[model samples]
Target: MRTATSIDVVDHDRRRLLRGALAITVAGAAGLLPAYPGVAAGGDAIRPFRVNVPEEDLAELRRRVLATRWPDRETVNDQSQGIPLAKIKPLIAYWGTGYDWRKAEAKLNALPQFMTEIDGVDIHFIHVRSKHPDALPVIITHGWPGSVFENLKVIGPLTDPTAHGGHAEDAFDVIIPSMPGYGFSGKPTDTGWGPDRIARAWAELMKRLGYTRYVAQGGDWGSPVSSAMARLAPAGLLGIHINLPAIVPPEIAAVLAVGGPAPAGLSEKERATFDAFIAAAKMGNRTYAAMMGSRPQTIGYAITDSPAGLAAWMLGHPGFTHWTYDSSDPEKSPDEVLDDVTLYWLTNSAVSSARLYWEYDGGRSPAFAAGEKTAEISLPVAITVFPGESYRAPETWARRAYRNLMYFHEVDKGGHFAAWEQPELFSTELRAAFKPLRAAK
Candidate 1:
C-alpha cells in the first residue's frame, strides 16, 4: 500500500547489516520472519552450490505439456491481444521433443549458485569471486521479464577482468540473484515485497559477504531496487549504478530540455548525458511499461505454453527497452535476442516466472511508476543510459533522488539487457562508476 504522495521523504528502515546473502532474516508478513542459523558468506557458511532439478519437476513440466488442451486459434488470433495458440502448439511440440532440460540445468550449475533466506523468502543467487586480489564487489539485480539469465554473457567479463582486456583491478566478485519469485527464489506468497524490500535484501546480501563497500548495478526492475538501496544507505553499499531509472520527472525534463546547469558533482559530459536520457524516456519507455504494469499474467500464460510465444513476448523488447536501436530497426542481432529468450525458455521458468506479476499484484505495489515528482536518493549513484531503454533518467531529475552521483555514461550500444548484450561497455561503466570507492578500499 502507498503511504501517500506528499509525505516527507522516507528513509529506509535502519536495520543492522546482516551477514551472508540468504541467511539474514527481516520482518516478514504479519511480523513473522524466517531464520538462518549463524551464517557468513565464507567458509562454513558457504554451503555446497548446486541446483537440484528433481526428476519430478522435469516430469511435471512435461506432464503439463502433454495434458495441454488445445484452444481454437480464431478465439484469439491477434498478436497484440495475447499469444496465439496456433503458434504455440508447434513450440510446445519442440519443447516436448527436442528441448534438453538437463543441459540447461548444467549451464546454470557451472556458475556457483547460492540461495539464502532474505526477509521471508528464499533468495537464489550466483556468486563468482574473481581471482584478482582487489576484485570489486558488485550485485546485479534483474527485473520483470528478466533473471540472472539475462546477464549470463557478462558474468565472465565481470568476474575475470584481465581476460576481457581490463585491469585485474576492475575484476568483480559479481553477485547475480533471481529476484523474488522470478527464478529459483521462493515466491512472494504474500505481499509487501516491493522495491524497498528488495533493496534491503541486497544490502543484507552484501553485508553477509563481508563487503564493507561495493557497487550496485541493475537494469529494468533492478534500477529502482538499487535506487531503494541508495535510499536505505546501508553501511557497505558504497555506490549505485543502474542501466535504468524508474522514471523522469517534469522538473528535471524542463532542465534537460532547456540545457541547464549540471547537478552538483557531475561532469559537463555527464550533464549532457542526462539531457539525452530525458529526451529518450518520453519517446521510448511507454509501450513496454504500460504492458508490464497491466495484464502481465494474461500474457504470461502464452509465454509459458509455447517457446515461440515466449520468444515473441521477449524478442521485440531489447529494441524498445535497451538503448541499442529503435523498435523498427533494432540494433541487436536476432541471435542475441533469441539467446536471451532461450535462456528463459530453456529454464522452463516461463510460467513460474510470470507468477511474479501475480505476486506483485497481490501486494498492490506499483514498483515501476514514480508517483513522486522528485525522489531523493541519499547515497552515491551512477547510471548507464543505453539506447533502447524505455527512456533515460536525466541527471536533473536524478539529482533530486541521489545526493551523491559519482559517474554517468551514455553507452554506445546496448539495451535493457546491458550485461548480456554489451558486457565490456557494462563493465567499463561499472568500473568507472565505483572507482572512487575502489581506491579507498
Candidate 2:
C-alpha cells in the first residue's frame, strides 16, 4: 500500500514509445473486440459481475510488453535509485510470455462477485456469507497497488473459520469491495470520491446488503476509510479494526514533517519508529506518494501505456522492497505480484487509483487525519501491528490516538499487505480482534 517515488528522470523517448504502442493497440483493437458491460446500466441493483477480458486485449498487453523500451539499469547498484532493472526485467519478461491473466481472472470469477451503484459510481465487491448462523459481518477494504485480490487469500479463512483452524463462532461474513476507481469498481468522473465519501458509500453498501450491523477493516488507504467509518459511528456499525493505524502524534508528525530529530520524551520503541519514518522519508521512499498526491495524471500516462512500465512502477512500492519474490511464498510470489499489476493494466485504473492520494490532501482529510483527529472516533477500535509494516506503531501512540481503544496486539510476521502476505495469521488476528464486538453484534 505504501508507494515509493516514481523514477526521478523522465525518459521522453520511453514516453513516446509507450504512447505509440498504446495507440497502435487501441486503434487495431477498435471495432474488432466485443464490448462487455462491466456494470449495469442504471440502478441500485446488485448485479452479478464476471471477468471476461477480450482476447485482443490480452494480446495487445503482450504486444505492449514485448515492445516496451526498457530504461537502462539504475546508475547505483542498490534500490536507492528505484526498482532495479535486474529485478524487474525477468518478471516483465515472464509477464509477457508465461504469466497467465486468465488464471488470475479465473481466480476472481470463482468468487461470488457483484456490482451495485453507490453514490454515482458502481462498486464491485466479493460478498461471501458464512454458513455459521451467528456469523459476524465485516467489510474489508484494500489499499493502493492492491485489489480485492490482496484479500482473496483471507476470504476462506475469515468466512469459514471452522474449516481453517478456527471455531464456528469465529466465522465472519466477509465483504471485500474495490475502492471506487480501483479494480472492477467504476471510476468516478468527477471529484469528491475521497475516503470520507467512500466511507459513507460503504455504509450505504452494507445497509443495502441487509446487514443491520457490521464491522469495518482496512490497511493502507483502507485505514482512513475504516477510520472514517469509525468516526461516522454509523448506526448498526459495531466496531472497527485497522492494520495501519494512523497513530502518529501531531507533535511528532510536525517534527518529522520539518525533518527534525525525535523529541526528548520518547520511549526506545517510539524513538525507533520515529527514526524509521525519518529514514524512509530521507530515502525518497515517500516521493511516490507526494507525486501521486499532487500530480497523479502526470505519471498516470506512462503507467497506463506500457504494461512493463506499469509493472515496474508498481514494484516501486515500499511494501515489496523487503518481500522475497519466490513462488513458494504465496504472499510474495511473482504471479501474485503480476496479478495485481495486470489488474491495474487491464482496468486502466492507474490514474483513478492514484487520485486517492491526491484526495488524501496530505493526510489532512477528516477521515485520514490521524493522531489527535482519532480522538473524535468514540467507537471501539482494535489494531494489530505487523512487524514488517512501514513502522511498528507503538501502543502508546495508538492509545493516545483512539479514545476508546479496545484491542492492540503486535504480530510476529506480515508486512503492509498483511492479509495477502499471511492470510492465516491475519485471519486469526481479525477473529481475536473482533471477538469482543461479535458479542455486541
Candidate 3:
C-alpha cells in the first residue's frame, strides 16, 4: 500500500497543454489506451518531473540499514552457497556508513526527467536531446534489479557523442524509462504490463516526443522490451540493439528444457555455449526468480521493510549478481550498487518490480524460453555479445532470428549491465549499430 509522494506544485498551463496533445495522439492507438487515475482530466499528460525525496525517508533508510539483524556466515567457502556474508558485510557496511543518497538524488535531478501516463500507468523516463542536429532518437530500457539509474552513465556519451570520442553525427537523443513499478514510475494496478505492453508504451512515448524515426537499445529486460518494439514496427521505429539478445534456437531450447545433452550437429562454439549454459543453470542461483515470479507479494514485505534484505536479494539475484562479470577489475564499485539498491528501497518497488517477472517468462531463465510467442521483427536489427553475459548468443542463432540483421559484434568485456559497466564501449557500439539506420532520416 506504499504510495509515492507527488510534487505539490506543477506548471498548470504547460502540463495541461502537453497532456492534451498526448491524449489526442493516443486516442486512435488502440493498444495504448490509458486507464491510470492520475492523468489530468483534460488529457494524457506528459508532465515534467523532478526527484526530491523527503529528508525523513533518507533518515529512515539509514536507520533500517543499521538496525538490520545479522545472519550467520555461510557454512561453505566461496559463492557456492550464494553471496556469502563476506560480500554482504562490506555492502551493508558501506550502505550504512559511507553511502550518500543525496548525491545520487542530485545526479538524477540534473537530468531532464519526466512522467507520462501510458497504457494505464504513469511511466517515468529520462530524456536527453543531443545537441547535434539530426541526432537519432533512441529509447533505452533498463531491466529488473535496475532502474533508469543503470543507464545514467551512457547518457553523456550517447546524447553528446562529440565529447565522448565520437563524431557529432553519432549523437542520439537518449530516452531512459523506468519500467512501470520501478523507480518513480507508478505501479500497475492490474496485470498485462509485460515487455510487449511496455514496448507499445515506448512507441507512444516516442510519438508524444515527436520522434518520427528512432532506434531502441537495452540489456537484460531491456532486450525483450526493445525486441517487442521492433516487432510492433510502428511508423518511426527503425531498428533495435540488444546485449542480452535471447536468440536461443528451438533445438537448443528443447535440449536445455529436458535436461538433455547437446544435439549431435552443433559447431564447436555452439556446443561450448550449450555446455556453459547448462553449467550456469545447475548452480541453483535462480531462487530469487522463482520467488518473485510466483509470489512477489510475499517477498515484498521483507524487501520493503529491510534495506539490508533488499540489498542481499539484489546482490545475489540470478540477473547479473556479481559486481562485474569482468574478472580483471570490477566495472562497478560497491557504492554504485548501493545507489541502485537504495533507490529501490526508497521507492518501495521491490515487490512491484518483481511482479514484472510474473507478467512475462515467469520463473523461467531468460535462456530457457526459446520459441516463445515472439513477434516477428522485419526491421533492421543489431546485437552485441559481451564476454561476461550469462550466455553469449551465437551469430548463427542471431542471424536466424532477426531477418534484417545489420550489425553484430562480440566485445572484449562487460556483462548484463553493459551500459552501466562500460559506457565507452556501449556508446561506441550504439554509434556503429545504428549508423545505417540513421540514413532513414
Among the numbered candidates, top lDDT falls to 2
Clashes of each: 20, 1, 0
Query: lDDT (CA) for every model shown?
Result: 0.60, 0.82, 0.78
TM-score of 2: 0.89
Q: Please, what are the lDDT tens digits per residue for candidate 2 over residues 228-264?
A: 8999888889999999888888888888878977899
Worst 10 residues of 1 by lDDT: 9-18
Lowest summed lDDT over 10 consecutive residues: which window, candidate 3? 5-14
List clashing residue pairs in candidate 2: 5-288
TM-score of each: 0.68, 0.89, 0.88
Model 2, residue 39: C-alpha shift (Å): 17
lDDT of 3 by residue, 51-123 (tens): 6666667777788788889888999986768788877787787778878887888888787777778876778
Ranking by TM-score: 2, 3, 1
Clashes of 3: 0
Q: Residue 88 lDDT in model 1?
A: 48
Q: Tens digit of lDDT per residue, candidate 1, span 118-218?
A: 77666778888889897888899887666676777678888887888788888888888888756566555455666778888888877766677687887
Candidate 2 positional error at 87, Å = 0.2
